[model samples]
Target: MELALGELLDERLITLDLQATEREGAIRELAGLIDRAGKLADRDEYVNAVLAREALGSTGVGHGVAIPHGKSPAVREAAVAFGRSRTGVDFAAPDGRPADLVFLIAAPEGAHDLHLKALAHLARRLVHDEVREALRQAGSAHEVVRVLAQA
Candidate 1:
């Protein structure tokens, strides 16, 4: 399958100014964004799944980025929510730094391989400093989509 980050990311799910100050709170806020976008049937259930995944290991990949994801029956489809925290949040990254860019991925329970592929693709793109900077400077959800489309 061709994984298009732009397709998975809804403008409504992009928050340029994230209000959460911690990892759990950030996840909750991002999950709420996805839920409000109608990507999730149950917001709390999806949040719990993401939290469970976090318990296994921090998704904080360093470079001020954190990708928190989960597979759940509550997820209606594969979707991504992006949040930018100007103040940064403590995500327990390996580099021991706060994360300013957060991507919350929600995938349906049946899409095991597809979800992994999507996550891998996103991770690869995020490794570039340019992409991170572009996302950080993005003015709106449309701008964010434009940046991710280039990835």
Candidate 2:
């Protein structure tokens, strides 16, 4: 079956109130979400992969959004964790705007790039101003999932 954003982004993985102040903290917080959902076999290993990717280049793709992803054996399944920061976290975005909307994609090491596909799908949705606005204003985890499901 094809990967679907609405399915991969389980509502249990969405957080409307992110408490991180920086990039790594934000990523760890999101990873914790995925781990709690039992999608990660080894949270540290998965987090290391993502931070390593960040070292190569910031995942912050501008427009107040950041998509951080990793492929590792630690991933039990392909999952997407969503977090929204009211105060915004500094993700070193190219546009220099703090990222308020963050997506953490976890894909298994030999899953043939599922994370990349999810990242691409989300990127397409985020380019629309209305979608971003809807996420920023989402009142609950279900609302956030609804926006992404429709977007």
Candidate 3:
């Protein structure tokens, strides 16, 4: 993947303790981070895009992970918001497991498929047990960044 996940991920985008109870809520919670970081041009539009994508198919990739993304004109740039929950949220995973690690990606419509690249890269990285364990045990946002950077 040409796009470095580290470029889209940062301490400001990481949430180690998520309070969301379900999929939609978790998405909204993470998308709010993108909005606050000034990457989202229009919160409602971007959120709608993500929800629409979810309607087409669940983004839950199994293994306690979910990657929800939106490629929309409402995004100013590519950004990722990550949340970790102690109590998992239902994401309709085929494995029938709730997701504790959630990633919300916002990509500008003109970002040249960066979102797909990020998704693929994260999928590849998270497939490793060490990476997932590091994420789960990360104590701070900086730790999360360090994990992704190294992974």
Candidate 4:
């Protein structure tokens, strides 16, 4: 099945002010957001999986964006959580700059290939300056969703 970004994103999963100043802390915060949304069956396990992925390579794709993701059995469903930090977080981005936008993606273990494809699509859309600017200027979670929907 093709995964739709709109179906995976929820306004409640968007956080305008992230409190984390570091990578791990940022991942934890985003994981907590999805967990609170009832998307993770085991929050710790899911977060650990994402951390493990980070160990392999930082997901900080630069341009002030970090896409941290993992496929694990702990995920109850495939979902994405969006967060923005006004102060920026040290996500070990390839460009060596702090990341202001974070997108944490959780996928069930069985959906490995699908996850990759979906992530690719999201990455392509995120590369557009217009989309990035819109997300940055979004005033509320609803506004964030609207911006993403337009992408």
All models: lDDT? 0.90, 0.92, 0.91, 0.90
Q: Could you give candidate 1's per-residue lDDT for residues 64-88 as a string of tens digits?
A: 9999999999999789999999999
- The stretch of ten residues in a row with the least summed lDDT in candidate 1 is 1-10
**Residue 138, model 3, lDDT:** 93
**How many clashes does the backbone of model 3 have?**
0
> Model 1: how large is the Cα RMSD against the reference?
1.0
TM-score of each: 0.96, 0.97, 0.97, 0.95
Per-residue lDDT of candidate 4, residues 1-151 (tens digit)? 6557888899979999999998889999999999999999999999999999999988989899999999999999888999999899877888988899999999999985866876886888899999999999999999998888778
* lDDT agreement of model 4 with the native: 0.90
Query: Which sections of candidate 3 miss by over 4 Å?
Result: none
Q: Which portions of model 1 show Cα errors greater than 4 Å?
A: none
Q: Pick the candidate with the highest lDDT.
A: 2
lDDT of 2 by residue, 1-151 (tens): 5557987888899999999989999999999999999999999999999999999999998899999999999999889999999899888899999999999999999999788789889998999999999999989999988998888
Worst lDDT 10-window in candidate 2: 1-10
